[model samples]
Target: MFKKFVLATSLAAMALSGAHAAEITFDEAIAGATVFEFDGDGDMVVDVRFGTDDPEGFNTVGPGANQTYISEPGLEGTTLLDTDLFVEFLGGAVGTLSFGFATIDPDTSVNFTVYDDNDNVLGSTTALATFDTGGDFPEALASVSFAGLASYATFDFFGVGSRYIIDNFNGTFGSTEDRTPDAVPVPGALALFAPVAAGLFARRRKAKK
Candidate 1:
């Protein structure tokens, strides 16, 4: 009986250890601190800017103007600003991308795509919302998996050209590499040896008698 108890305890410990593994959060990701400029390639220009009109005027664009243009002429139709943020997971595990965006035109649709380092689209989603017209902000969230991705090195975010005001943009990737262990009882293995343990115990009890 003591031996059986020890075996069970060891199994339980193993399971618990597996379940308690640590996982990487979005903030811990290396690409989390990166901020990409839309249309910074000087190819196409878009009339969009970021930041408040506070005294600090901490805007992404130059002075006097609240909007910045892509300035790229080749990018005429469907102007999209794309940035490649590299992220790598050491272990081969499932990973997810979580992101949220606020837009001005609630009626217009926006497309978000996740791409590998090679520029292949792994996943994409489009959000359509009714225009508030009152200038209120509407938010949307999307998540994607890292399975079958060309490479885990980089992910891309493509913003569809529209008068969309984006704020509070955040992204996070989660992985199962840090899942807590599950204590699964090995009933089959235990049953296979149960008869032997029972026989030994009976023999010992008979000797005592």
Candidate 2:
């Protein structure tokens, strides 16, 4: 009875830990991939549309983090300005979200806005000095984070003469059972569970003897 109880508890804890966060590095993504449903859900995770008429949506991956970052296509001479990247959380609202940002232009300020499920603005933030040639394009990239229950977010690069990119997008889901396809079990919880499981097995062996 004790062994069964312990086993059940340990499995429950691991299950709970597995559902807290979801992340996307975009390494597995193709250069022009538009939608990213990290959890394999039909819901739209990200929409990379540039404008209404441009069908070549979803900018190609940038030259950073092993070419894993999503970059702005060369539209400098075109009519496109103040380009924005949108990420939608169609499953449910997330408690927090963060991403890495880089730009070719120095001291560029990028604006981020979070919206609730109703499309109401929840909050906003501006990240500056995204790229200073500190190391490489993605190295030393600016880290931007927003705290709130958000259903979607937009990153705007207004008047940025050069190109910019974002990678390592992460979100903490509001529901503990919400998770992504690549989401892993929490390391701390796994460590704690290992000993408990071992002890339970040992106790069961002794009881059998």
Candidate 3:
């Protein structure tokens, strides 16, 4: 019965988020492919322009850490505008992009703005950055998902200093990725009735007996 209850809740949460997910870890990014405009070399990524500095080059550290992590190169303070990265999908708008995140202080500080093919803002939210304190760089993989069909998304790593990195992007765009939401957040309406549903289930069981 306990297993069944957990399964039901997980399913409910996925149904509520309302977006198909996709992810990528720079590991699969073509080593010499031009994914970023600034990365003239074969670096895993190019800088998206953060506070007058665009750091290019990524590193891998931690347990089984074979993925790439692009860290901000300069010390630009602890504000949201210090670090930025632009992820341009090969195919325009391949669902929402999410990944594991990490930062210097290991705090919840970052923001995101998504755009369509024409560089129009599809949506902006403060919910994109989730801090996952696991790994040598303190990784948090896609604690937040930017929902929609987007050409690309700009992620700003803001916190008490801009020493940030991301890895294990799990979403719809890459191979060896899981589009399935194992434990997505439950939607608002469903969240409200969680306790009520449990109570109702209890009542139904009592009546059945």
- lDDT against the true structure, per candidate, is 0.35, 0.51, 0.47
**What tens-digit string does per-residue lDDT give for candidate 1 at 23-139?**
221121112123222321123431112122122221121111121211111111111233223333222222344433333334444555555556666666665433232223444
- Candidate whose lDDT is highest: 2
Assess candidate 2 and give its lDDT: 0.51
Find the candidate with the highest TM-score and give its number.
2
- Rank ordering of all candidates by lDDT, starting from the highest: 2, 3, 1
Which has the higher TM-score value, candidate number 1 or candidate number 3?
Answer: 3
**Would you give me the overall lDDT of model 3?**
0.47
Please state every model's RMSD to the true fold in angstroms: 15.1, 9.9, 10.4
| Alpha-carbon TM-score of each model against the true structure | 0.33, 0.54, 0.46
Q: What residue runs in model 1 are displaced by over 4 Å at the alpha carbon?
A: 1-94, 130-135, 149-161, 165-209
Model 3 segments more than 4 A misplaced: 1-22, 28-56, 63-83, 125-148, 174-209
- What is the per-residue lDDT of model 3 for residues 1-209, given as tens digits with 9 covering 90 to 100? 99999988886775565333333334433222223332212333442221213433433332234323333221122234443556665444434555555565555555666676788876655532333333344444444444444566676776554555555444344322233323444588678889999999999999999
Candidate 3 is scored at a TM of 0.46
lDDT of 2 by residue, 16-90 (tens): 654234555554444444443444221334322222122444453555433223332211111134535666665
